[model samples]
Target: MSSIIHILQTQGGEIWSALGQHISISLISLFIAAIIAIPLAIVLMTHKRIAEVILQITSILQTIPSLALLGILIPMVGIGTVPAIIALVVYAVMPIFQNTYSGLTTIDPDLDEAAEAFGLSRAKKLVKFQIPLAMPMIISGIRIAMVMIIGTATLAALIGAGGLGTYILLGIETNNNALLLIGAILSAVLTLIFSALIKAISKLSLRKMGILFATLIVLFGGFAGYRSIVKPPVNVTIAGKMGSEPEILINMYKELIEEDHPNMKVSLKPNFGGTTFLYKALQSGSIDIYPEFTGTVLQALVKTNQKVSHNPEKTYQVARKLMKKDANMEYLAPMKYQNGYDLAVTQSFAKKYNLKTISDLKKVEHRLHAGFDPDFYQQNDGFPGVKKAYGLDIASAKTMEPSIRYKAIANGKVNLVDGYTTDPEVKEYNLVVLKDDKNHFPPYQGAPLMTEKFAMAHPEVKKTLDKLAGKISESDMQKMNYLVTVKHEKSSKVARDYLEDKGLLK
Candidate 1:
């Protein structure tokens, strides 16, 4: 409980900002959904067949996964809050549309006759009596939509849509359970609060409720107009992979880059899929810059490499050339340290198996259990490609989060974990990192990768990125990783401390 409180206190500013974004996105989506759905439902009511079909279409859209919907919107409309809001609106339309149709169609026949006896026209009957009489049900539909929109808005972070979900994803990536809990609880609370607010609004008399509508208009228009009018100074976006090392590197980059270009506005967005998803995001312009390792770059796409190369520089050159030729992305200078994959085992396990190298472990591979980060598993240069190259396939292989892989191995949940060379937990847990004797693992020299257009377009940004090349040594990166994974230091703080010590920060 104290830990949770600590996480909340430290993240209060971020929380408030996320709340505002959450409300803005959800309300905007709900408003749009109501506009389209309420009218469409009424139109479709006259044609029962079309009404069923329209509802079916909306329901089918709801069936699509939130992430999939977000991804689909990326290539078509681009990323950020636009795609997120569009996806939310798509998801929201169903509840309100369904409720509107049912609410109107279920109205008492006597009400319709009464409206006619009062000399009301068909349209006037709907406007003055039917819709007003069905107000409770329509509001109920909106309540449901609002509740869902608030909860689902968390996925907005995946597409760079800022919300509390950012904290949840960040928490998972950094192995901060307290942060994860706080983010989840807050999201749930927001959903409940909106649902309650809508319910209260529904209970109010129609006259009072109409005034609330005016307030909503002012809030919505002001918020939307403000977002559209206000622009960032430079609008440079920096994306990073999900794990601690990548996050630390990117944050340090952000600090350095911003210091270099004070007038530039910088935003850091972390992708959960690491290189696997990040590279594609770069191609689609979802993100501008991210740190990548040569090893991962070698297998950036599936089936691109038949085998992993042993040579580090060669791997870098090939990756750089391919990225340029294939996607116009430039691989900038690599840092001094190489954070390669270390197929690690607990000290006790190593002692028991006499495991000295990757090949040695391969001998008893059939009997052992292996766990790898999803990023590693997905990369052809990652576990699968490496394993195939080395002729070792542990039948009992499981995908694990990068942050907890070490703990999984230490606690006997997994016999082997695909650990990073820079991970401090490998040393802390007294684990034996098996050597890649066959040189199956490629060099994973850390470097900043950016689209060529962005590089050429922003020379100062490129120069700032280049200045730090080969600066962060193996030891320096390890220290930062240790501080976060073991000492519980925030990645940004660890990065700041490292930069200050290195005299990188002005």
Candidate 2:
């Protein structure tokens, strides 16, 4: 509890900023959904068949997995708040529409007859008789939608839409339970607040409720106009994939670039996503720069049928050339370290199997139980490549989160894990990496990657970032990762310290 309080105190500013963003996105999504759904549902009350079809469509939309829906929306609408809101609205629509329709349709027939006998027009009947009676059910639907939107809005972080999910994802990646608790607790609190607001609004007179929604619409419009006129354009937006290493690297990039160009407005989106998501984001112009690796560029980004060279320099050259030609992206000079994948096993397991090379796994393939992250389990350059190059496949394999795989192996829950070379847990868990005797794994030297257009326009930015080329050594990166993941040091502080120690920062 003390640790959580300390984290909140130290990171209070960021937490507030993230909370604001979360509320903004959730409210926008909820408002848009309510406006679209309630009106359409009202109109469809007269057409039962059409209402059923529309409701069925919304139900199907809700059935699509949230992440998959976000992925699909990325290509059409791109990432960030727009796509996030669209996905959230789709999920919100069904509940609001269904409840509103059910509420209106289930009204007492005798009340309708009384309204007609009083000579009330259609509009008067809906406004005076039906709506007030159905207010509870309508409010209930909106409440349910708001709760769902608030909860699922966390996923917006994956696509660079800032929210509490940033803390949650960072926590999971770095094993920080305090950060995780903060995010979850805050989200729950926000849900309660919204629930209370809905309950309050449900008791209001129709005139008062109408005034409130009208006031909200006006405020939203005025804020949008003010933002369009007031906000300055961000010159550079740098992002990083999930993990302590990428977080640190992006921080270094931010510091170096801002130091060189003091007038430039730079933004950092840490733990933006995995390689493929970041790559797609780059292509779509959602993000400008991110730390990437030579092996990932060659194996995942711009896959080639030709054999890749094992030599570091040669691998870098091949990846650089291919990215420029195939994806119209620039691959900056790589650092000295290689954060490549290697199979790891406990010292006892290796000793028992006499495992010195990846090929040696063949001897005990049947007995081996492997734990891998989803990316490694599926990527062609990961498990599949290992199987093809070494003719070894474990008898049992399970996919788990990257952060948990180390613990799984260390606890003997699994005997093998797909481990990164620069991971601090490799040493902490006393695991040995089997050599890639066949040289199947390509060099994974890290570097900043950007689109060609951004690279050409900001040559000075490239020069400043290139200063980091060949700077961070393998041991240096491992130590930095350890500082953040094990010692609980902030990534930005660790990055700044490393740069200061190396005489790179002014």
**Candidate number with greatest TM-score:** 2
How do the residues 336-443 of candidate 1 rate in per-residue lDDT, one tens digit apiece? 888887788888888888999888977788878888887777766677776787888676888877767777887888888888888888788898988888776777
lDDT of 1: 0.81
Evaluated at residue 199, the lDDT of candidate 1 is 79
Candidate 2 Cα misplacement greater than 4 A, ranges: 351-354
Query: How far in Å is the alpha carbon of 231 misplaced in model 2?
Result: 3.2
Off by over 4 Å in 1: 110-119, 227-231, 301-308, 347-356, 360-370, 396-400, 404-415, 428-430
Instruction: In model 2, state the lDDT of residue 27.
Output: 96
Q: Candidates' TM-scores?
A: 0.90, 0.96
In candidate 2, position 460 carries an lDDT of: 97
- lDDT by residue (1-506, candidate 2, tens digit) is 99799998899999998999899999999999999999998898889999999999999999999988888788678777999999999999999999999999999899989988989998999998688888899999999999999999999998888899988988888878888889999999999999999999999999999999999989989987998899887899898988899999999998998899988888888877677778878888888999888888888888688788889999999999999998899999999999999999999999987999999999999999999987788877799999998998679999987778888998899999997999999888889999989988888999999999999999999999999999999999999999988887899999999999999998
Question: Model 2 TM-score?
Answer: 0.96
